[model samples]
Target: MSNIVIYHNPKCGTSRNTLALIRHAGLEPTVVEYLKTPLGKEELRALVAATGEPVRALLRAKESQATELGLNDPTVSDEALLDAMAAHPILMNRPVVVTPLGTALCRPSERVLELLPVGPLPPFTKEDGEVVNDSGARRA
Candidate 1:
């Protein structure tokens, strides 16, 4: 098993694109479909800590229930947010990657490159048809 892990949601284009980048790097990552196999509160906390981001940063605030679930309330505590995310996994943002080098919330997909092994990558085309060159820069 590779020392890389990606919390993924296959239905999400960004997640799919990020996974493709990992494959393009000639490495395989442990894919965790968080929606299917939800992470426990503690696990979610650990993952957030690993990313050096607040719980709100890893939250999928655009989810329909985010407002209804009161997750948007500014007064909510980290523990409360974590509890909600653990109970309803959809509240959690996706495609968070952990590698030996670092952890990142790979929303742009290409952000995964930062944690990937340093090497030349084949030009990659994302779901939106944007191409990233081997140096991890978008081809102009």
Candidate 2:
């Protein structure tokens, strides 16, 4: 099994579903409630690098602080955004799952499956004899 860590926000449905999927897949991941125990600046930067996404993409744009801080404006610098996220973890995005090999942003929740260790998940049929769809709901 892959060594996994999940930065989770319990209040978010996406985060809850991601945890459920991980458990259903038979992989136990270390859960980090990021809102309660936030990531440091260095860790946040590293996660951005690991995911190969821009700093803004990692932020929770819907957060009121983002608007209050004028983070939605294109003029906002990466440093400024990072500082905001560090200061207000509520502005950080939902579950960010990391594996021994790589990390993924579990946005829709299903994305975490890509970080799973190679091999099919254990088989379990639904009541209708169809495989369970662990893939999460699509976001707008």
Give me the candidate number with maximum TM-score: 1
lDDT of 1: 0.88
Q: What residue pairs clash in candidate 1, if any at all?
A: none
Each candidate's number of clashing pairs is 0, 0
Find the 10 residues in a row with the least total lDDT in model 1. Answer: 131-140
Tens digit per residue, CA lDDT, model 2, 17-119 = 7787777777888989988898888889999889888998888998888999999998899899888899899988888988865777878776766776643
| Model 2: residue 103 alpha-carbon error in angstroms | 0.9
Model 1 Cα RMSD, 1 decimal: 3.3
Which candidate gets the maximum lDDT versus the true structure?
1
Give a tens-digit lDDT track for model 1, residues 16-101: 99999999888999988988899999999999999898899998999988899888888999999999999999999988999887
Candidate 1's TM-score reads: 0.93
